[model samples]
Target: MTDRTATAPDIVTGAGTDDACCLFQRALGERFKDLPRSVRDLHTVKGESGWQGRARVTRGKSRIGALICRLVGFPEEAEDIPVSVTIERRGDMELWRRDFGGKMFASVLCLRNGEERGHITERFGAMAFDIDLQLADDRLQFPVARGRILGVSLPRALLPVSEAGEFEMDGRFHFDVQVSLPGIGMLVRYQGHLNPVRSDD
Candidate 1:
């Protein structure tokens, strides 16, 4: 069989008014923006097995906390993984709100050529947490829940890249991530894509 995997290109650079609405909608989808209830959808990889399931969100109700997202996928590799994400909105400040949280789940959906790999899920919190950014001498700095931090540095040529394309928007948003699990030791050098959903419906 021929390998049909699509390779992403290096980040591109450009200048365009960074629109929050565009970014949010691109990350979480328009359906999630207006709904205050549970939501679900299918997730697929370009040349790999796809996942189909639903996500339930209990808004500020129940003992779980404020916001909770529960998603279930398919295939033996991802069948047992249930991503549990919690979202909390900070103060009612003007524009940006402080957001921070962790993801607790597991799956082999990120595998490349049968090797189990760590993949970033679309429902991950960091994917949709928006904030105001500043360009320093040559670096980009943004604030998180803990404090001001250094944001991902993309080449000047890859600024306008969206989640739709293979290079810019793949299964995983950040290619460089350091995750340390109890028994799993550490997961490094991870990357993948969350293929774009067709249609606005």
Candidate 2:
């Protein structure tokens, strides 16, 4: 219900010069211009911005899946839940905070260097996933190609899997993100639409 992004005036600094501030554009290069207006705008993090929307938060029914979701502060199963997202830039890292109803979780995103070149790395708690941003049919897809726990790279077959993407429909930015473990099935799936919060709202 609260728009923390609008109030975080100190989140952006003029000196912060990280491509992650505008992650998609950096990765897609000139092709970024071909994306839908909504998708492009939502991924462009300038300072701290807020987006509001609705989502269906579904936790996997599996025992381990539910436990993992709960441990990561995921929202309980719900439909038409209010969603709020805030993206803040701190140096080369982008802190993305999402609120599903009253429950909130955050992740840090940046461009990968080390071993995985030209990939976007997202860190949620102790798990870090390297995602390759690929555009297909006006959608930006996030494919988790590699994963690490506590900075230690995991084996190839043991890496967690993710099916995520962003697009636009009916003039609103929509996203579907689902992550799953090797044998644990789905971890969580949240699909919804978001619009930039305007001053009038």
Candidate 3:
């Protein structure tokens, strides 16, 4: 599927020309403008062939953190794995659907930014958490922010950090993501290249 039309201007901007929400939203888009335009579009992009790639996930060194990864349903292995990712823009939020080694995972990301607030839903609201972002020069960092389990906030001290960097290499779009904790070392890191495949969705 292709969303050829542009999404409407953000409603939050109607409050005022210099409202905090409007400022942050514009800043967020400007920071990552080097990426695919669809990344900033609040509309779905899909294809029958989709995007194909490879990923490697390295578990954290801390034993407790590794255990927590298992408990939280993270794959514990550190090896090269084939994967596919499908991203769709739904309203103001984006849905990233990934299939790795036959196990599917999905996350919902809300792009509105204003002082880092609220629990963004994921997996169709089976999970939700607030996220803190550090966006700069085509790179985005998800510094550990407060999270919620069943709407109960988790301690800030226990959250982990994750960051992503995107660029073009060998004429293909490339991205790298790393997850780490203060005392737990690195949780997982994945890097891959993707090229668009044209097809009717």
Candidate 4:
């Protein structure tokens, strides 16, 4: 597997202003001081501490939604899954990485006007797919993106409905996300709170 992040130098460049870059880096620095050492030491997500939480995944209600989830290798049902996530600076772009159980996932996020756009790559068994994603405020919005399976583009109609968001509550981060399809509501949804952890813990 290739590290797409390492190959894209231009992807991290082109911030609109030095002020924005400074603010982003400063924010990450404060955030990094709050993470577990193991996660903070990763090459891409380095120098930052983040949150740990538990999330639940509910099965979709509609048959189409269930089918889409299965096609993408999501579990039929899951709950209280432990999660650890971090966001750090890699060159000029932000590197966000999440560890769900032992599965590793990552995205390279570009921030503009308090919003973000990025490429997400997820691995399911032996298959890995690239997804386009955007985030504004606390809401994750997808504007007609495609998934690749075995180097082939999957059908748009079958794409799981994607909904996600994150925010702070009680000084901790919280997030909720759902994937569904037309007529088949909520293939999977996960939500939980994230608390800061120390490197020694």
Regions more than 4 Å wrong, model 4 = 1-47, 61-76, 112-161
Worst-scoring 10-residue span by lDDT in model 2? 1-10
- Tally clashing residue pairs in candidate 4: 6
Best by TM-score: 2
Which stretches of candidate 3 lie above 4 Å from their native place?
Answer: 1-27, 30-49, 76-78, 112-127
Best by lDDT: 2
Please give, for residues 1-201, the per-residue lDDT of candidate 3 as tens digits: 011111333112222233323222543544434444433321223211266677776666778777766544555464777777776544344556666656565565564343233223232233355555564664444554556666676676665665756555556666677766666778666776665545643
Q: State which candidate, 2 or 3, has the greater TM-score.
A: 2
List lDDT for all candidates, in order.
0.22, 0.78, 0.51, 0.52
Give each model a TM-score: 0.20, 0.86, 0.64, 0.53
Residue 160, candidate 4: C-alpha displacement in angstroms = 5.6
| Tens-digit lDDT track of model 2 for 103-181 | 8887777777623334788877667888888889888888888888888999977877888889999888999988788
Query: How well does model 1 score by local distance difference test?
Result: 0.22
TM-score-best of 3 and 4: 3
| Backbone clashes in model 3, listed as residue pairs | none
Ranking by lDDT: 2, 4, 3, 1
On a 0 to 100 scale, what is the lDDT of residue 162 in model 4? 60
What C-alpha root-mean-square deviation, in Å, does candidate 4 show against the real structure?
7.9
Q: List the residue pairs that clash in candidate 4.
A: 32-48, 32-49, 35-49, 37-199, 60-186, 161-180
At residue 30, candidate 2 shows an lDDT of 82
